[model samples]
Target: MSGSPPAGSQQQGAVPNPGSPGPSSPTAGNSGSSVLVHVAGAVVHPGVVELPSGSRVYQAIAAAGGELPEAAADAVNLAAVLQDGEQLFIRTKDQAAAVPGPGAQSGAAGAAGPPPGGAVIGPTAGTIVDLNTAGLAELMTLPRVGPVLAQRILDFRRQHGTFATAQELDAVDGIGPKLLASLLPLLRV
Candidate 1:
């Protein structure tokens, strides 16, 4: 027993905590919280991936089976943090060039679709957001809507039931004329 370690204790830092998630675990970070991101475009696999919360864009790309040879990987800010229900689209080199960068001209709201080359990263940018069924994450995708407003909308729906008309959203607390008008085109009852 001279050279043996204590029976109840192991070498310091040598034994991992059994209760903790290992590096290989899907929930290694963010305390077991995870987010689903839809990675589309030039990746080898285009689909949704479940990543630990606070995962970066590059992780999403890797989760989608890595970028294709033709993917304009440089166009993506790989260090950007991923959000739940987010869509991370990788465009081809040619497509990347076609899509304007920040400060570029965007058509009137809801008048035109997202720019070519998958420049838009929102999950509901050009898609219809069903007010009655939309969740907090989906509602947050709308312009000018944040966690508080999104929750308010949900509370309103639960209290008053399904929205009969798109305009009905204005009745929700904090949803003023300007906000309602801005969200009208992107919302559907």
Candidate 2:
């Protein structure tokens, strides 16, 4: 027989090569790529979680120790794809009720109104700013959107045309998932 070990056999105390894919190696499975998401609100353990890329909202919730008993499941789209740096807010039943109903363009009981010339719906349904038509001043009114970021948003819109969806803001620099979540309820096509 040739001077060689049989198939699947290796020398005693032998170690895998550095470049080889071991059983625990990330490349051996789908564990290598991951997306960081921040899950807050009515979760059992709310915090940032690193989930496999392409994970959904439900998965992120599970990663955050699953939702609390008071979690308003109906308020969230659990099947929604999770994006890196995104924040998933799990509202309670009361908080869910605070969200405005459809076509609620204005009039939130005991809620603060939107800025001048802006329409307020409810606590969750903030003013709707059209991405296509909002000027620099209007854009700057968004949470965490300062002059520089608003200018960048304008520049992006100028170069790329109107945003297809609020998530498209992620394409603009300085806008991460947390910021996008805050801006989503306040934006229109």
Candidate 3:
């Protein structure tokens, strides 16, 4: 017999041919590793984006067609790692001012507790309340949210876990789209 090995057998240290996929190739195991994320606000295309498993916030934004001209880039942590099924809300400069400072939880981290001082600074130095964890008193600070409506919000929260998104406020009896739109800038999930 000749010294050479069989024709179809791989040599000990030889590189695999590029045309054929190998067992360790990226394409071999990447099919189900994609993460689905919802990117909204301040992005040119505000909707769901599919990205690789280890994608970052910046990549998600790019998948959503990049940020809008009015986006508050400074407010976002572009390097933050993305999680599947998370919603990324990019605020505008005006909207960014309404959000609480650095310690506030965002994205898939779950609902943030009330601000330390019970308020966050808005664009004009006014205070904005967090809907997910705000007490009835804090809720009353919102436009048109009086004692009764505030209590209703509290009741709703007690009945159904945390507010996953500000849009959930619509489930509260008295809140509507117009009010939700106004509240959007002054609230956090």
TM-score winner between 1 and 3, please give it.
1
Task: Please provide TM-scores, in order, for all candidate models, with all chains considered together.
Answer: 0.47, 0.45, 0.41
Model 3 alpha-carbon miss at residue 103, Å: 7.0
RMSD to native, candidate 1: 12.4
User: Of the candidates shown, which would achieve the greatest TM-score relative to the real structure?
Assistant: 1
Error of 2 at 74 (Å): 2.3
Off by over 4 Å in 1: 1-30, 104-189
lDDT of 2 by residue, 71-173 (tens): 7755554555665665566666676666544221121212322222221111233547778766544464455555467668889998999889878988998
Native-referenced Cα lDDT, model 1: 0.59
Question: What TM-score does model 1 achieve against the real structure?
Answer: 0.47
Which one is best on lDDT? Answer: 1
- In model 1, residue pairs whose N, Cα or C atoms come closer than 3 Å (at least 3 residues apart or on different chains), thus clashing, are none
Model 3 per-residue lDDT tens digits across residues 25-141: 222134557666666667666777656567666666655556777877555555655656656666667766664443422112234332322221112225455677665434544
RMSD of each: 12.4, 16.6, 16.1
